[model samples]
Each structure stands twice: as C-alpha cells, then as structure tokens.
Target chain A: MIGNAGDMNVVVCVKQIPDPANPGSLDANNNLDRSSKLIIDDSDMYGVEMALQLVHAAGSGEVSLVSMAPNGETAGLRTALAMGAEKAVLVSDDTLKGSDALGTAKVLAAAIKRIEGADLILAATESSDGYTGTTPVQVAEILGLPSVTFAKHIEVDGSTVKVQRQTEAGYDEVTCPLPALVTVTAGVVEPRYPSFKGIMAAKGKPLDQVTVADLGIDAAQVGGDGAGQKITNVTAAEARKAGEVVVDEGDAFQKIVAFLDQLKVI
Target chain B: MAKVWVLAESAGGKVSSLSLELLTKARELGDTVEAVAWGADTASIAGDLGAHGASTVHDLGDLGTSLPGVSVAAAIAAAIEAGTGPDILLVGQSYDGRDVAGRLSAKLDKPVLTNVVGLAAGEPPVASHAIFGGATIVEATFTGSAPFIYAVRPKSFAAEPSGGSATVAPLSVPETGATNAATVVDRHVEERSGPQLDEAAVVVSGGRGLGEAANYAMIEELAKLLKGAPGASRAIVDAGWVPYAYQVGQTGKTVKPTLYIAAGISGATQHMVGMKGSKNIIAINKDQEAPILQIADLGIVGDVHKVLPQLIEALKARS
Candidate 1:
C-alpha cells in the first residue's frame, strides 16, 4: 500500500492554552484570560507533527499551520514554521480574543478558506480549557466537509484520507474523501524539534493574520458573550486524604506478611 | 419538545455494553429518551433500552453486522429530520460511537462532546470529561444550539430503569457523500476479558511496582473476582507487562470507572488524566511517597504483591 501512495496536502489547527497543571484563574464571569494565561497546549503540538509526517512523506503538497489564539500568537505560528510547516497563518483579533470552541472554529474555518484549498485539516481531539472537543466537527460541519475525530493514524492520497479512528475498544481504518477534517490524539508521532537553522528560517516565513472583523463576523459571535454557555465557576477539587499502611518494608515486609496472613491469602 | 435520541449500537441483533450505558445516560439527560437501532432485528435490545428508559426506539433495520459509521450517521440524521428532531443526540464513546458522532455532529451542525462521564442540561447541554488523566475535571457545555450530538463516555453516568413502551419505527439510510467514499473489507475484533474497560465500573490498574509482566496475575485475579477491568500504567505497558490497549494515561486509554485501584504506580499527570474522574480511587504502592497516593481515596503504603494478595483474599472471602 505504501508503494501506491500519492502526495497529500495537509493543514493543521493549533491553539495556545494555559499549562494544564497551573490552570491559573478565571475572572468574575469564569472566563480564561487569554493574554495572561496563554501558552500552547501539548496536544496541539502533536497535531503539528502529524501534519508534518503527511507532508514530509514522499514530499506531497504543503503543510500549513493555522492558530486561533488572541492577537500576537505569531510566536506559536513561528514555532510551527521552525518545526517545518510550509506556511503559517494566525487567525487573531480582539473579537475572537474570548472565543470558545464554536467561535474559534468559525474564525479558523474562514482563515482556512482564505488559505489555498487544503486536502485535510488536522486538529487535536480537545483543548485543555474548554475541553469540549467540538471544534473539528463544528469546522467540518460549517465547511460542509467530512470529518474523523480522534484519528490515530492517517494515510493520504491528494484529497482522500484513510484514517485509523481510535475507539474505546480497538480502532477502525475508515477512508473518507478529500477535504476532510481530522482531529488527532497523542502517540500518532513524536513531534520534531526545531533546529537552530530551522528556527532562524522560521522567522522569515509569512504569517498572515485574520480577525473576526476581517472575517465579517458579528463581534458578539467572537467574545465571551458568544459562548453559548458560560463557565459559572472554577474551584480546586477536594484534597484526598493520605494512604493507609498495610506494612512497612524489610522488617515491614514481615508485618505486611502477617497482615496478609490475617487476610488469609497465604 | 423534540425527543432526545440515543443511537444504540448493535451487532447480529444484540446490543453492546456501551449501548446500554448510553441509554442509561440519555435517560438521565432528557425527559423523553428514544433509541435509534440498526442491524438485524434488535427488538430485544430495544426492549432492554426501554427497561433502561427509552421513550422511542427508531430501528433502522439492522443495516449489517458492521455498517460504516458514516452510513449509520446518515440514517440517524434522516430519522431526526423526519420525526421530531432529537433535542440532543447521545452516543457511546466507543469506535462506532466516535465515528458516527463525529460525522453526525458535523452534518447536523451540533456539538460533538467526547469522553463524558455525566450529563445535565441547563441552557446548553453540559457534560463532564475526565481530563489531565484524572487530576482535573472539566464540565463543558456544548458549543451551539439544540440537537447537539455527543459521544458520551461509557460508565460515566449510571444507568436507570425508566420502564415503559418505546415508539419503534423504521429509518432509511441517507446517501450522504461518504456512501461512495470507502467500504469496509472486513473487521476483526480484539479479544480481552474483564469487562470493556471504558464500560467497567470498577477498574484495577497496575504499574511498575508489579516487577514483572507475569506479576500482573495478581491484579488480573482481583479484577476477575470483582468483575472489574484491569488497566496498566504507561511504564508497565512499555515494559511489556501488559498490552498497549490496557495502558491508562495521557499516552494510554482514558477510563472513568466508579472505583479505580492503582497498585504500585507513581502517578504522572499524564497517567492521572485517564482515571481522575473515577468516583473512588485506591492506590497501593511500596513507595508511600508515590504521587498516586496524593489522589487516592484509600492508600495502602506497601508493596502490591503483599497488599494485593491480602485484598484479593478478603474479597474472595466476602464473595
């Protein structure tokens, strides 16, 4: 099957998120602050590597990176360029500054439409903040295209993609016609490191920017007001109590052995 | 109000565990939960869905044992359109559920919510997904309007009996674009005991502390007696202690069981995301300092070989 492979063009959607550990804070309205708490999520970074593999394989069509972060997400775009995306486009704007999954996809779809047509659009299954995991399907829906969620492996030929869709059990290899959207999971491929030379070259790549205004979108559609549901609150989970001691070690092993003896497995 | 739809998965006239779990959650979310079934005569499964709360069961005439998920999605969409559109479409988070939900959500312009453990509706339908392995919980609401389709996490919500008659009807498969896209040549299912992990309410997971792959027997033995599923840390899976399918972490499968037992494993944030949403967590590790102990509801500071045997014996006695 590899011998009969054809060239493929792939585009990936990347989002910058706050590190999950330090989810940081939200406002009175339960809104995540973009400027203060923004960095790229690790999963989206993997999405980049998946795209690179498709484009790098047999030198098919171009691999492009599209980010839907607030204005000044060019650093992420540059990062993608350094990692070897052929081009980068940032869909940024104040209106989209507070976009949720739907608004973000709306902006991204417009940005993707502006770019030269793509054979596939790649994305992570979910984002850390919203964690809703709805953007890919929403984008595919709005664009009137087919989509596969949580695709573990993708082999492409021009516009058609044979995707290994992962389920709770095993996986299924489903082929969908060209111009489909695929949201990937981890372990698809190890992301590449940006070399010094590649980093330098990335600085010179074109990074066209688009905002909600640029897309002729309703400003209300791009902000906190646009999110169909608002986050009511964010609080730390209740702390767990420490563990029980069945036995210590060495000498504790004997005590544990005694404990097990009581339970009667011995 | 448009009746909510639950797409019941079946093969050879029988429903999978995930379908039952989905029906359980669907009844919890909507007032009128109806099921859309396909593949052979699923009248029995339809009855089962009613026993677990289904107002209507729209059977699409058993398309086949392994119908393309996209084709099933088309049939579901057509049913939604012809009858009252489902207020929200609920599905299992399995492969077919994921495939059908992804295609249906896009085609229907509804939100796709995956790996959910719970469901509630206020304005937009909200679902809970165990993220960051299990350290954090995300309560996310669908992005848009009603009829939002979701592939809910199995075992996340408890199934209940809403016993009553369900309206069973026929739905024709729609020839959406994917009809000519790809065809399934054949399908082979991976065999494993210990209930489907995602569908298991009790999951006993092991880690490097087991010392050897054969040591997994202790964990498996306990899981079997309890009728629970067994999960492995990435390190154990990488060490070849267990198959990759059993690994539960950022790098492994995600499970939101009711009770999760972690034996002899240090918890990485990656590993925690997979099982954090478990209602109760118990960790037994030789290292009392293991990070897993931090999230454990009941932690036993000891080697798994010692603690596990005792625990297993206690369980066996009780049974």
Candidate 2:
C-alpha cells in the first residue's frame, strides 16, 4: 500500500552549516555560531543529488527541500534549488536558536508535512557540522514512516524503495514501502554544480519561509528551554606530548621496524 | 542508585565487543546494570551479558527479517511507559543503535546525547563528548527527563567481565504497523583479509600522500606483512581510492591498536582523534612538519613511496 502513481514526489532534508574548514567556535551559550553566512552542508548534497536522480527516474515528479536555518537563510536552499528542485519550505525562527537534535527534527518534520503528496524523503546520514546523525530517523519516527539509514545506493521500483544500506561490514539490501525516509551516505552520487540558467531559475523558485508559530510549534518547545541536555563545560583535551622526530636518514624504515620490534608487535 | 541499561548487539551467537564495553561502563556508573537485545540469539548471549555486569537482559525476541529500529525502539518505549525503564540508556554508536535511539527519542519526546566518549556517575549522570574533531571536550548532562539516552562511541571504555548471571526478561515489541515496513532482503559482507581494522594490534593507514589509488596496494601489502589491518584517511576515501569502511577518522572507525603506522597522512585533527589513542604511533611522511609526526613515537620524515617499499621488504626479509 505504498507505491506512488508513477509521479514520485521526493523530499530532501537539507542543512545549511558553517564551513567545516573554518568552523566557528561556540558562542557564549555553547551553541554553534550560525549568525554569519552559511552554505549547504557538503554531506547533504548527496541526498539532494539522490533526490533529483530519483525524481528523474520516476519520469514525472519533482524534488522538494525542507531546511531550518536562522535569519530565513535562503542561500543554501538556492544551491539545491538550482540543482532542479521544485521548491522548498524554510523554517527560520529566533526562538529556535539553541535547538538540539530532537527540537530541530520536530521543526523539520512540521515543515515537511506542509509539502503535499511527498512519496519519499531523503537526508544525509549525518551533517558535516553537528553530526548528531539522528535527525532523519527522528523525522521518520515523528511522521510514523519507516526509515533506512546509510544508503549507498537507492532505487525505486513501483511503490517499493530499495536501498543498499551501508554498514561497517559491507552493505545490506533493504526494501521499504513508499512514503518512507532514507538517510544517504556521502559520495553516493555526483552532485551537479549550478549553471547560469539553473541559478537564474532558482531565484524564481518558491522558497516558503515559515516560523515556529507558523508551523504550529510552540516557542517554549524549541531552543534552549526545550533542549533535554546542557553543555556544562568545555575544556581543551589533554594533548599528547610530541615524541622523537628524526629525519629519515635512509634507515627510517629500520627505526620504525625497530620501534615495532620494541613494542613486540612486528 | 541509578539504573543503567545498555543496548546489546550480537552476531554469530557472540555479543559484540562494543556492547560489552558499554556494559562495563554501565556497571561503573550505576548500581543496577541491565541489557536489552533483539534477535534469535538474544537468550544465548544473556550469559555473556551477565558476565559483563548486566543483571537483567530484556529480550525482544527474533524480528524475522524486519529491521530492529522500529520494533526494538517501541519495546523500550513501552517499558518506560510501564514505569520499568532504566534511569539511563547507553547505546553504541552503530547503525541499528542510532536508529533505535532516534526512534525512542521521538516516541518519548526526550533528547539524546550522542558522540559520548566519557561518563561519570552523578544524580543525573554527566557525559563527555569530543567536539571539533576531539580538539575540545564538552561535558554535558541531561536536563529534562529520566531514561536519558547516550550514543557512545566504540572503544571508549574497556570491556571487563565480572562473574555473574543475568535473568532473561521477555519484552514484547508493540505493534508498529507502517514504521516497521522496512525489511532486510539481502546482505553482502565484503571479502576482508587480515584482522578487523579496529581489533587489529597493528594498523597501517594510508592517506592522499599515497599519490594514487594504485599505491594503496603498498599499504595492504605492508599490513599483510605485519599481520595487521589496512586503514585510510578521509581524503583518500573521499577520493574514491578505497571504500568508506577503510576510513579512520572523526566520522569513521575509532581504532585503539597497539601499533599504528600512518603513512603519508598529514594527521588532520579529524584523523588524529581516531588513531591518537594507539599505544605506539609511527608516522612516515615527506613533510617534516606533518601533524601526525608530533604525536608519533617514531617520526620518519621520508616519502611513503620509498619508505613503504623498504619497510615491506624489511618486514618480508625478516619473515
């Protein structure tokens, strides 16, 4: 009872994050800084790409995006939109500043429900930043939909979604009904860069910005107040002291082998 | 006295070492330590769990091809609703563990603390997580509710057996209709040689410094010569030079081997956190200033292309 009628409506959960290379420090409240400009997470791009490809394979569907960013940030959504997504629902509220993983999932699931007729949902296994790695499955739980994580490959046959779910050992072929959610692994597909025409088209794409109140979520149930955990303190980890530094004088391998020998491991 | 429950996993009728590690940590944190497991072998592994300090084992029985995420989570939530749940639930940072934790969090409307590396006993129990690729350690504690869930990283604690026996308790999985629709149709375990990456005493990891994908063969050969395992940095794994399973870094496997040999790896903080715990580290790189060398017991400032072959030959000659 899950397959769609040929037109597969795919929803991708996209996250806009601070650049991992120049990651910002925690603010006074120990929350990650998001006041500055943000870009789409590199990890989420694979989900975006997978969503687009699935829609393409379905022949008559569209890819929609759901994101929660501060200040109604549309920059990250624009990138995904340029990649041929039809529209997006952005949840931006001042009260959602210090939202934890569960709070964020609540907001996302609320926003996703607004998109009608979505047959499948996709998200990255974990974000590049804030790798809580539970948002997609949490969203599925809230929506009462089946979920699969760590997908290296995905295909749609009729109403069933088949995923090659990645595991530490290898991978498992999992099949779920339509209207399910999947968290895609990174590098599953090659994401396309935005071209001039796509970028221009993205500007006109419908980016419906909403607030917590608009999504029928209480301000008290989000941000720091609703968070179930608090960061009591943060300190530098004990650094390992630097050890012997010897420039390889042709006997470097010998020294290494000797060290291994000393350890009785070789 | 706080009650702690660990989500245990088993394969080949043996409890996973990570689960035992969690059980060990749970014993240190709580007066009552219990375990929750699914699958047909749950009863078979109860004794092992008991030896690891679990006094009680909640068995969800066999799932019959259905993924454990939905049913296992529902069963735990049902227990909590019945006022028989633990004060804290510790789950390993694994695929099924994350799924169960996330679903249970949603079901109970409680937040979960993930990436935990340390824990200390307290009224509510505080957990420590490494942030920014383990550069800064953040100590956090639950604020809202009991049965606080923590997804702990593997190898964070040592698994020790304390002589005991656990009483198996049957827990029924609530009828989860649509959410339990996903089922495993097939499984494929890749052919692996040598010891497992995390369990291997000697681990030789390569990086982008290996120059090309073909050069990874040297890493495999050297690890084979040393009777060890092969690993890789995120750079080469992202480059598609190797599978993600070989990755050893912030987002990958956490290895604490006796001897770790990093070849051509620049030792990004992300990479360092994963292998820095090794008892002895040896870094071979052309760049004398590579960060990996700083923590290495033996720093060999040389090109891996030249140094690896020599090490391989030297190791081969000895054998």
Top candidate, metric lDDT = 2
TM-scores of the models, in the given order? Answer: 0.80, 0.95
Q: What global local distance difference test value does model 2 have?
A: 0.89
- What does candidate 2 score on TM? 0.95
lDDT of 1 by residue, B46-78 (tens): 777778778778777755424346677788778
Candidate 2 C-alpha lDDT tens digits along B1-319 = 8889999988778998999999999988899999999888788999999999999999999999888889989999999989898889999988899999999999999999998899998868899988766768999998876889999999999999999899999999888999999999998998887899999998999999999999999999989988899999978887788998999977789999989999989987668868878888889989987878878888888989989998889988988
Q: DockQ, in order, for the candidates?
A: 0.26, 0.71
Docking class of 1: acceptable
Residues A1-266 of candidate 2 have per-residue lDDT tens digits of 22357898999999998876674589999998887788999888888989999989989888999999867888999999998999999999889989999999999999989998889999998887788898889999999899989888999998899999887679889999889999987768888998899999999999999999999998988898889789999998777777888887787888877887888876
Question: What are the clashing pairs of model 2?
Answer: A3-A159
Candidate 1 residue A97 C-alpha distance from true site, Å = 3.7
What's the true lDDT of residue B269 in model 1? 67
Index of the highest-DockQ prediction: 2
